[model samples]
Target: MADALLIIDMQTGLYDGPEKPFERERVLATLNLLIQRARHAGAPIFYARHTGPAGSPIEAGSPLWQLWHELEVDESRDHLFNKTRPSCFLGTNLEQQLRAAQVKDLVIAGMKTQFCIDTTCRVAVELGFSVVLPEDGHTCMDTPALKAEAIIEHHNATLAGAFVKRTCAAEVRF
Candidate 1:
């Protein structure tokens, strides 16, 4: 299966709050490394930015909707798709872009572990694409009741080896 990298919602909005996500620094370091590795290997890289409705923090065309400054974005080299919902495949050109790139295996990593990352991973598998999830690549903020680490672990436990294969950051070859 040909592989592609889908980096979803690593936007300013996700990082601009009082509470930061668990393992955020690690997520950024690992995700950034994966991006570089993917580019070096000539794999198709897709950046999925969330486009919230009007009045939302990440509203379409808003500054918060933009990718963080640290993310390496080259419009001429990578594909960018705006998603209206949590799942990247819903109401976006993601599938078409994947098909055009002849991508059959997806390596996904991004924000809000139980939302976009989870939804997209399951949907991709259901849609017949192989999925690979780097264990340290995604994260979310902690709620008042639950810790971010626990939420991340819970999702990882639920998704890994079932909906997707869990691998480490440096171990991901493509």
Candidate 2:
């Protein structure tokens, strides 16, 4: 089965806001490496952008809605999906796109470790695709209940080998 890299919601709004999470640079670096690796391996790279309603922080045309500049998005080579919900498949054509590409496996990486990342991972698994999550490829803001690092670690530990198989950016193989 063919595999594609699914980069979820790595938009400017999530990383540049007041409640920014630590280790963002590290996550971006890992994502960049994964992009390069996916390209070199001839795997399709797909990006998901979250578009909030009008007046919302992530509203369309807002700087926060754009993908981080560190990862260059080549429209010709990559597929971009704009989502209004947490799960990329909820109201979007992600499933159609993946099916069109004949993709059977997905390598997911992106923001809000427990929300968008976790939701998409579960949905992807339910959709019958093999899900691969790079341990350090996703992050979230610190909450009163848990630190950002703890949230990330908890998700990685819990999701690994269950909802998704946890792998590091360097260990991912096409």
**What are the per-model C-alpha RMSD values against the true structure?**
1.2, 1.3
lDDT of 1 by residue, 72-154 (tens): 87789899889888899998878888988888889999898988999999999988889998889999998887898898889
Residue 99 in model 2: lDDT = 92
Write model 2 residue lDDT over 12-108, tens digit each, in one string: 8887788886698888888888888888888999999999999998998888899878776778879997999889899998999999988988999
Q: In every candidate, how many clashes are there?
A: 0, 1
Cα TM-score per model: 0.95, 0.95
Instruction: Give lDDT for model 2.
Output: 0.88
lDDT winner: 2
Q: Which ranges in model 1 have alpha carbons more than 4 Å from their true place?
A: none
